[model samples]
Target: MATGTQPPASGTDPRRAGHGVRGATRAAIAPRHLRTDRWWLAPAGTAAGLLAFVVYSTWRAFSNSDYYAAPYVSPFYSPCLAENCVPMRHGPNWELFGGWWGLSPALLILVFPLGFRLTCYYYRKAYYRGFWASPPACAVAEPHTSYTGETRFPLVLQNLHRYFFYAAVLVGVVLTYDTVLTFRDEQYAWGHMGVGTLLFLVNIGLIWAYTLSCHSCRHIIGGRLRHFSKHPVRYRLWGWVGRLNQRHMQLAWASLISVAACDFYVYLLATGAFADPRLF
Candidate 1:
């Protein structure tokens, strides 16, 4: 019902008005797809190199000949520790290399040294800090203005980090169990290998706990904590978790140190430099 209002007279369609409005809007806002120099490569590279060292050193941990009788023993044996226990097997046994490849645990060594740096919220905030997670010689450069635009890969999956928290926590539990097991295994035949294996297990718990309790995980799972301080019950419970979340970087480094500690514990054992216990 047209009450003196004129309908479109010819070629111009009403939809054209909506398109024009959108076009004008796009012209007003600056485009965001800027290019930056890849300075993150340096730290990333160094981290990778160190990771390689961990892998190689881990391989050495498997050499059976490296396992020999401990040169000294304490006359006072501790059953709980499995201290003064005998070796699981005598040395010069290459057949044990496959089993010794317990070395793949070394592949994880890089996660402690390298991956930890990548997950930092502070690094995420600054280009200089962020580059450390990448490679060497990378620089802080301006955002690129080329604005080619998104070809694909929408970032919806980033939410999966919340799920990763579950995985990391589970791994922590596994590591804790491994530590508990180390004590059991060494009880029957305490040696360097037993103690070393236990140490690795303990470090696993440290790293996984650090990773699972990271700030990134908080963002992924905690949703937002802006007003929770007003809620007492929530503050009491969630506040505890947030404490770890706030100290994310510390946890990362702590985990890194613990992982190395774990590796050393076993490496020395594999070489017979120390004695483990016989828990069994």
Candidate 2:
């Protein structure tokens, strides 16, 4: 009798029986899911929300008119430093290019906030799934053959997120100054508070919440530490930031809505469509 190992069954390849083949030519096969839920809904809603905000903000930013009301300036046009900006008693008077730039004041400052959000890690994930449909949801196949990731040309700009965060902080300072200025009436006297003032306060609060809750801010607070015990202060600071970071996504969306609402409120006041009720 021959003692050689027996041949495998007719249809079975012994080497391929249990393990996945290396360097296989065949495309990957996705597994079937038990749940038949509406997975597209979340991405669809995200896309719609983002689109609506973009449209509204773009229109308001370009409008240039009715961006200010006494004791209230639209967050879109705060720190109205452009020469083309409607005359304001406060805010910087510096205008570039000999004041010939006939652009909305929002144009000068919106870039900072926009760049910060654009390069935000949370926002990148949100829009990547929402707008690009890059594997829109789990279990769904991506439209692209492969992903180049953020290491490539345009996406490489994401590395500027930390720098944008610094600019955002400066912009926040300017906005805070604008909010403080809101306390004074048109005559510039103090002791005035109105619904507009409340709006500005809430808007700034939400902005700070969003900005402080950033992952980059968390890393800056305490990254590359060899030992937590050695840096007690940084450890505590990191703890606080981590708590905020846990809710960063919520803060981000809330801030977005609050800012838009605040801008719209100022617009209404400026347009005489609505009045700011006195709280005090």
Q: Say which candidate scores most in lDDT.
A: 2
Instruction: Write candidate 2's Cα lDDT for 44-109 as tens digits.
Output: 998898899999999999998988788777888766767787877775664543344577778888
Model 1 weakest 10-residue run by lDDT = 72-81
For model 1, what is the C-alpha lDDT against the true structure? 0.44
Poorest 10 consecutive residues by lDDT, candidate 2:
26-35
Candidate 1 local lDDT, 1-280, one digit each (tens): 6755766558755555344464443333344333366545645654564565456545533332232223211111101122222343322222312332333222332333333343344333332333332212324333544432223343243334445555555555545544444443332343334444544555665675577566655554445657765666655655566777677656665665665555455546656665565333
Each candidate: RMSD to true structure?
12.7, 4.0
Clashing pairs in 2: none
Q: Number of clashes in model 1?
A: 34
